[model samples]
Target: MVSKALIQEISQLEADFCSALSDPTRLLIIYSLADKPHNVTELTNELDIIQPTISRHLKTLRDRGLVYTVRNGSSITYHLGDKRLTQALDLLRAVMRDRLKHRASLAKETKATINA
Candidate 1:
């Protein structure tokens, strides 16, 4: 039920947009935005990152279309463009957890065989 063209399009979007998520700080920003919107100052203070770093991360997120902003008075609040992004991240985390457990089990088996 999947088409090659659709896959190509999705692949391009992933390359262009998801690249921003490759940074740990950006991932943290996404997770943090899931709870509530935050301005640059709040994010910098909460994440213990410098102001310039947070601003740079936010710029990347905005460029990637992963985040957006709302102007309020003299401040801007950054929001996740979609809630499903967090769900996708959670699914990836679960997959990673399973892979880790599988690797641990294999290591244990190997150790037992070596000791035998």
Candidate 2:
């Protein structure tokens, strides 16, 4: 059985980390950084988002400890805080795909029933 304190910790972490990921643009940024670190300009070009928007999302990610930055001369590059972040995202995507497939099958069954 899980302890109440553990559940509370999980809740706090979810609030901290998952809230940062609530935006699709942020998710795209995460995916973009999975390959390699990038500065704001590079992320803007890669994700086709405006530099300001990318900076805003990056700040959110940085605040959540989801990404870390390194400085090279005047440029600052962001890297994923942990590789497992992408793995977790991939797992969520798989779950979403499974849910959609299930819903499609249910819809097909309902349509067939109506026709019958």
Candidate 3:
């Protein structure tokens, strides 16, 4: 029931989403914003990244629809727009943990073979 144009649009959006997450700084920004809203200054202090860098990454997340901002007087607080983002990050972390465990097992087996 999907038209070619719709499929193309979905593909483009997927690519954009992946591109948005391609940077480690952006991923960290997403993770930080997942818990609560924060302004650039707070994010900079918590992430230990420079203000400009935090702003740049936040802009990328905003563009990708992963975050939204609320203006309170002079401070603009950024919050996660979708909770699914945190779920996705959690799944990724689980996969990474599994991979690490597998690698450790392989390393142990290799060491045993070497010693044998």
TM-score per candidate, chains pooled: 0.88, 0.89, 0.88
Cα lDDT, model 2, residue 67 = 99
* Model 2 residue pairs with clashes: none
lDDT measured at residue 112 in model 2 versus the true structure, 0 to 100:
100
| Model 3 clash number | 0
Runs in model 3 deviating more than 4 A are: 1-9
Q: Give the range of the ten consecutive residues with the poorest summed lDDT in model 1.
A: 13-22
What's model 2's lDDT at 17? Answer: 81
Assess the local accuracy of residue 3 in candidate 1 as a C-alpha lDDT between 0 and 100: 100
- Would you give me the overall lDDT of model 3? 0.91
Q: Candidate 1 — which pairs collide?
A: none
lDDT of each: 0.93, 0.93, 0.91
Order of models, best lDDT first: 2, 1, 3
Report the error of model 2 at residue 110, Å: 0.7
In model 3, the worst 10-residue window by lDDT is 28-37
lDDT of 3 by residue, 1-116 (tens): 99999999999989998899889998888888887888989999999999989998888889888899999889999999999888988998899999999999999999999999
Candidate 2: regions farther than 4 A off:
1-10
